[model samples]
Target: GAGVSQTPSNKVTEKGKYVELRCDPISGHTALYWYRQSLGQGPEFLIYFQGTGAADDSGLPNDRFFAVRPEGSVSTLKIQRTERGDSAVYLCASSVQGARRTEAFFGQGTRLTVV
Candidate 1:
């Protein structure tokens, strides 16, 4: 890990509980992503792996959201019941592989608070 590496950061579950957000990318990148910010705007992709499949995931926003990246560097973002508008701030990015336009590496989020 030398860049993207999200973890606890700040999470407060309640409304239904069931959250698992984690992303550790940077050792090789390969194009991993998952975004969601809600206090103002921007960042709202949701899913997009490239090595372990999930080319897009259509910006997950239903079925309680879901994401994964088996061995493509590490990635996981599952949120079941939880509500309260599903508090936001859960980003994670990476690059290299196909570059998606270049410039990625971003991991300083994971602020879910669905009390």
Candidate 2:
């Protein structure tokens, strides 16, 4: 695609349902990231990929959250047993690796609402 693309711009689910969000980053970009934004706060890093490997996954709240980028391009975030606290905007960013400038371009985001 063109810029980053995220699926399910908005979602409403029960307090304990599984949800999957998709993201397609710009072509040829070597770095991809996922972030979570709660109300009245900045985006918090969730995970990052430098290619097919996960460069950083430290910000995930728990083991229930996971993500993958198979071809260093498109990625997906899988959440199991979603909780109300998990309701927030899920964002994706992509940038070139080691560019000194981490001007990450973000997608519109998926607003996941766990009722």
Clashing pairs in 1: none
Worst 10 residues of 2 by lDDT: 96-105
TM-score of each: 0.32, 0.95
Q: In model 2, what lDDT does residue 78 have?
A: 94
- Model 2 Cα displacement at 14 (Å)? 1.1
**TM-score, cand. 2 vs. native:** 0.95
> What does candidate 2's lDDT look like per residue over 1-115, in tens digits?
7798999899899988999999988888889999999999999999989988898899999999999888778899999999999999999999877366778989999999999
Candidate number achieving the greatest lDDT relative to the actual structure: 2
- For model 1, the stretches where C-alpha displacement exceeds 4 angstroms are 1-14, 17-30, 33-48, 55-65, 68-78, 83-91, 98-104
- lDDT for model 2, please: 0.91
Candidate 1 lDDT, 9-115, residue by residue in tens: 99999998899999898987788888899998988887888888888888888988888888888889999999999898999988887554788878998899998
* Each prediction's RMSD to truth: 11.5, 1.1
Model 1 scores what on Cα lDDT? 0.87
Q: How far in Å is the alpha carbon of 8 misplaced in model 1?
A: 16
